[model samples]
Target: MRTALTEMLGVEHPLVGFNRSPAVVAAVTNAGGFGVLAASMYSPTELDAQLTWIEEQVGGRPYGVDLLVPEKFAVSDPDDLVASLRAQIPAEHFAFVDALLDEYGLPAHSAPRGEEDALDEIAAAINPAGAQALLDVTFSHRIAMVANALGPPPADLVSRAHADGVVVASLVGQRKHAVRQLEAGVDVLVAQGTEAGGHTGTVATTVLTPEVVEVADGRPVLAAGGIATGAQMAAALALGAAGVWCGSVWLSSEEDITPRPVKEKFLAAGSSDTLRSRTMTGKPARQLRSAWHDAWDRPDAPAPLPLPLQPMLAGRAWNRVHAAAAEGHPGATALDTYFIGQVVGGFTELRPAAEITREMVEDCTRRLRALGELADT
Candidate 1:
């Protein structure tokens, strides 16, 4: 229960749950683990509102915010970056998305929401300017930490967060990335493997964890990817992780905002039912295998566009697919998928977020003790 992560964050447990829903974040934090809210999906104003709401629910418990700050992206003038990115998306990509929707017999003729709304959607996730705005808003909050989801935190951002007495963390897929992040002055490193739900590298956790731990040079490293149970958490500790950074396990929690159709798919999925596909985000992220991936993976299908463009092209279609799936459309259901890790196979039922946190800690304690007995023998 007492690892560097727990001590550094001042939490009762070393389990850090990263989720998009404020409810789940608050629940995990209040249940004695550090909860991190993924803020890339929100605009500055929306993030402010969500963080304020989470603060009220958690009642002074420490929580963190995660932002997608990719090291490489298509460069453009900051003022017009969103518009520039939007313009770069090829017409063929849009046509491909439309064709897929049409083939499924879904409505392909929805009216445009508006140019401003479209620009906002594109900028919110991939633009550096948007991420900066979100960081400004996050610092205004009582956040305990800030994590860069894709790569090392920008140097200025790290300095700014440090000045405000907040710890900065970064997720790394490789040992070299871990060293780069530490050099960038990150306070913690999350060594995520390919089995992780969202953006990840091809390395397995079992290999990546120890490699990162060795290179970390006394800095704390959290093990991620394919970790869902207490035994796995114990294994991560045995592998030299300060703790575990878990995301996918929380998706099946009752407090999670995962769509019912997507949740059903996750619940039914086996360990192999997921795949790394660029169909969701331009980057290869692990998501439950579905017809959506099947379409994109076809040899004849056009290759996915880079970064922001790919998400921009498919974002609207995904919204429509989820809406139709909610309405009992089989085609939409077939296409519906969400980011989840390989540990999803163990998610047989929905439980409260608090209960899951407590059980994981208790189970991890028991498992570690059992291992100690084996060592004695």
Candidate 2:
């Protein structure tokens, strides 16, 4: 309970929960774990409002903000990148999506939305400007830390955070990435493995966590990926992590905003059912292996558009598919999917965020005590 992360964030536990919902973030932080509200899914203005709302709800509890600043992204000039990527999306993809909808026998839209509107929606939804917007709000608020999910925080961003006296952290899938982030002057390293949900690397957590700890050179390292249980948290700490960065386990919790159908799919899914597919987002993100991934990964399928474009192409279709899935439509069910890590297999029930946080602490304490007794022997 008094580990470096808890001390750093002024929380009661070393657990960090990453979620997109503001409610879930507040709940986790109030429960003593550092709640990280993912900012990639909002525009700058929207993120500002969300962070402001979070500040009101959490009542000054220490929480953090997460941004997606990928080390390698398709866009060079953010604006031109958005524009060019918009033009590159083929109309055929729309046709395929429409046909899929028809197969589901869902109500057809009276008129199709324009490509620009669709593109702008997705870009705005996961735009980099959201990161800048969140930075502005976080620096203005009592945010304890700022994290970059996809890569090292940009130099300017990292500099700004440090200048504001906020601890900066980045997620890395490999030791090389950890070194790169450290050299960039990140305060903490999040060692995420392939078992993580969303974007992840291929390395297993059992091997990657210690490797990252070794490379961190005493900087705090949070082990991520495939760590849902308290025993898993204890294993991460025993493996040299200063804390645990958990995401997937929270998806099925009561505080989580994940839809019921999607949550059910995750609950029924095993660790092996998910796949690393680049079809949804431009980069490889692990999601429930559904017909959507299957359709996109087919040999004849067009290569996924770049970061903002691919999401642009799929976002509306996804929304429609998800709505249909909620209605129990067959075609929608084929495509309704969400990201969850391999630890999803461990998610046997839905509980409150506070209960989950408490259980993790209790279980971790028990496991560590057992290990200490073994050492005494």
Candidate 3:
């Protein structure tokens, strides 16, 4: 509880809850843990509105924002950005998506009709200027930390965050990546492993945490991946982590934005139910195995595209899947899946985000205490 993460963020608990929902973020921060909103999921205006609401709920309490501030991203034309990016996606991929939907007995896929397009969010994250626009919004707020979820932050971004008195953090799967982050002036390192949901590497948390800690040179390192309970948090601390950065556990929280049907699937999943596949993001991300992954695995299915292209192509299809699945469409349900980790098997019911935060901290304290007594004996 008294690690660098707590001191740096001025919170009682060193836990960091990363989620896309503003309500979850506010709840965790209010419960003494730091909550980090998934900023890249929203455009600048959306990010600004969400951050504003979080501030109102927490009343100036500390929280952070996580973003995909990749140093190297595909450059594209700024004018008509969405169309430009969509143009890069091959016609074959679109045909394949249509075929997959029909094969699953679902209606043909259609792009979401709304003011807020998921594809636009992808465009914002990959475009350098768009990412800078997000940074502009983040810096304007009273954020305690700004984490680069994808890779190392640009030098200018780091310096700007530093100038704004914001703590710069990055997620690293390997020791070399940690070194690059350190050289790039990252203030915190999240040692995420293969057991994590979303984009991850091959190493397990137990192996990668200590590896990152060894090279951290005393900077605060938060162990992530497959950590959901206090016992797990204690294990992270035992491995020399300043704290634990948790993402999957939030999916089981009531405040989580994941659809109800997907939540039901998660409750029934086991440690082995998840697999790392590139079908979602073109990068290896661990997600629950569903018909979606099955479709991608067929020999005729095209190899996954890189980064923005793959996500842009799949984003709309996911929208269709979620919308239909919510209505008890069996075909959509079969194809419905989202990023989750091995710990998802442990989820039995949804709990309030604050309760989850308090329980983890309290349990971690008790476990750490018990371990200390054993060490003394």
Candidate 4:
């Protein structure tokens, strides 16, 4: 509990919870762990509203914001980036998605289709300009930190965050990436493993954590990926991590906003039930094995488009899938998958986020004490 992360983040426990729900974020922070809200899905205005609401809920407890500022993506003219990207999505990909829906026997979409709107929804998630806009909104608030969920935090973003008295953190899967982030002046490093949810590299946490810790040279390093229990947290500390960075564990928490059917799927999933596929975001991200991914993985299916386009195309389809699943469509239910880590198999119940944090910390404390007793003998 008294690691460098605890001191740096000013939290009683070094457990940092990252989630898309403001309720979950506030709950974790209020329960003595730092909370980081994922802001990549939100527009600047929407992010402002959510952060403001979180501040009201946590009542001065420290929380951070996470943005996806990938180091590289298909570039385009800022004035019409979405339009440019839309044009690049081949007809075969669109036809493939349509064919999948038809095969599922789902109801036709009743809502009007707006390609521009879909592109706009995901533009910030794939481009630096969109991330910059969100950062502009973030610096105006009383956030404790700003994390780049993907590549290194942009130099200007890091400098601005530092000037605003907020810590800058970046998630890296490779030791070399960790070195780059440290050299780029990142204040903290989240050494995430391939087993982590969402976009991740091909390194296991066991190996990646120590490698980053050694390269960190004493800077705070939080171990992430496949960590969902106190025993795992204790193991991370044993590996020299300042603490654990948890995301997927919170998805099964009571405060999470995951759809009911989707939550059921996550609870039933095993460690091997997930796959790293670009079907969701273009870049490889771990998601529950579902018919959606199965269709995309077929040898004949059109290869997924690159970043932004892949998400843009899939985002609309997912909206339909969720809507139909809510209305009792079996096929839609089969396609309802979300990003989750390998630890998802342990999520047997929907407990409160606060309770999850407290229990994990308490268990970790007990384990450490028992280890100390053994050392004394």
Query: Which residue runs does candidate 1 get wrong by more than 4 Å?
Result: 76-78, 115-125
lDDT of 2 at 53: 89
lDDT tens digits, residues 325-351, model 3?
999999999999999989999999999
The estimated TM-scores of all candidates read: 0.97, 0.92, 0.96, 0.97
Candidate with the greatest lDDT versus the true structure: 3
- lDDT, candidate 2, 1-377, per-residue tens: 67777777788889999998888888888888889988776666767888888889888888999887655545545565556666677887777767767766766854355744644654643544545555676687778899987767778888888888889999999889899899888998999989999999899888999999998888889999988889999999988999999999899798787777788888888889899987787778888898787777667667776676777777767767777788888777777898888888777888988788888989999999999999979
Candidate 1 global lDDT: 0.88
* TM-score of model 2 vs. true structure: 0.92
Residue range 201-317, candidate 4, lDDT tens digits: 999999999999999988999999989999999999998999999999999899999788899999888999988998888888998999998888789999988788888788778
Rank candidates by TM-score, best first. Answer: 4, 1, 3, 2
Whole-model lDDT, model 3? 0.89
Poorest 10 consecutive residues by lDDT, candidate 4: 115-124
lDDT measured at residue 347 in model 1 versus the true structure, 0 to 100: 89
Lowest lDDT 10-residue stretch of candidate 2: 122-131
lDDT of all predictions:
0.88, 0.81, 0.89, 0.89
